[model samples]
Target chain A: MKFGILVNEGPYTHEASDTAYQFTKAALEKGHEIVRVFFYHDGVNNGTRLTTPPQDERNIVKRWGELADQHKLDMVVCVAAAQRRGIVDTDEAKRHGKDADNIAPGFHISGLGQLIDAGIKADRLVVFGD
Target chain B: MLHTVNKSPFERNTLESCLRHAKKGSAVLLIEDGVYGALKGTTVSGKVSEAMKSVTVYALQPDIEARGVQNRVLDGIKLVDYGGFVDLVTEHNATQSWL
Candidate 1:
């Protein structure tokens, strides 16, 4: 099965991101393909590499990046949401006159069309949100 | 359709609204704080118990155990893990997530 994952919350603040990550991992382990992982709303925060947490705690941002690298996952941070929340890639940063970019590895910025495309392509679109 | 609720019933009416709208034989899988709705002795327990008659109810096992309410889940509400979460999505033709 091909699955579309939609995440709508931040890393540490809500369990939504954790649950979504678990679900995505489980699906991949079961030999299902992830059509895409679409980050919208506060979920865009998951794509920022600037996050740092206590060493004792799980690093949610790095975890997603690792998962993407392992599975060759297509992880997209919504461009509109990322801009509003200050998550930027090199291109976006340069386009907006920002000096630096904070987007984490294994993620790219895109529009809502990618989300809609996932809905059309995947057999199931699972949403994890607050 | 498979309906997912992620907010505590005590904090929001999402579960109630989902139950009211879900068609007969639909599945309701509660996760995160929504696992609270699966408890046996809450104010909304009766409501959940009743909804089971029309729609099958499930609670994510990881979320339940994380909150340490595994023992108090209402009887007959199916418990599932993340793998089972994947199974539910494949079984259902569509899914709706209620915040």
Candidate 2:
């Protein structure tokens, strides 16, 4: 089955990121297809590479990056959310005159339409959030 | 449809609202703090039990374990791991997260 994930919370502060990661990993391990992961609301923070978690803590952002690399997953951060939270990729930074871009690898910034598209394309749309 | 609620029933109305609108035969999976609703003796458990008359109910094992409420979980609420979570999503046509 094809699945799409919608995460609506940021890392560390909420369990949504951890649960979403676990669910995505389990889906891939079970040989199910993941159509996309849409990060919206505070979830867009997961796409930022600038976070410095404590050494003993799980690097949620890096974990997502690794998962995306291994599965070639489509990880999209909602553009509006990212903008509100100051999570900018190079293109977005350039367009908005930001000095630096902090978007992590394997993730892209896109519009909310991608979320609707995921719902239309995937067999199921699973949401993880607060 | 599968409706997932991740908030503690005491702290939020997510579970109650989800149960209120959930279609008959729909599934509800509790994760994170949402597992609190599955605790056997709680007031929320009564509602969960009532909802069970019409819809299937489940809770994530890891979340229950994390919250240290495994022993308190109500009898009819099945516990699922992440893999089972995946299966539930596949088994249901769509998922609605009541955040």
What are the models' TM-scores? 0.98, 0.96
A11 Cα displacement, candidate 2 (Å): 0.4
Docking class for model 1 is high
Task: Put down candidate 1 lDDT per residue, A1-130, tens digits, no spaces.
Answer: 9999999999999999999999999999999999999999999999989899999999999999999999999999999999999999999999999999999999999999999999999999988888
Residues B1-99, candidate 2, lDDT per residue (tens digit)?
899999999999999999999999999999999999989888777889999999999999999998888899898999999999999888887788898
Task: For model 1 chain B, give the 10-residue run with minimal summed lDDT.
Answer: B62-71
Clashing pairs in 2: none
Residue A78, model 1, lDDT = 98
TM-score of candidate 1 relative to the true fold: 0.98
User: What DockQ do you compute for every candidate structure?
Assistant: 0.94, 0.88
DockQ of 1: 0.94
Candidate 2: misplaced stretches above 4 Å? Answer: none
CAPRI class of candidate 2: high
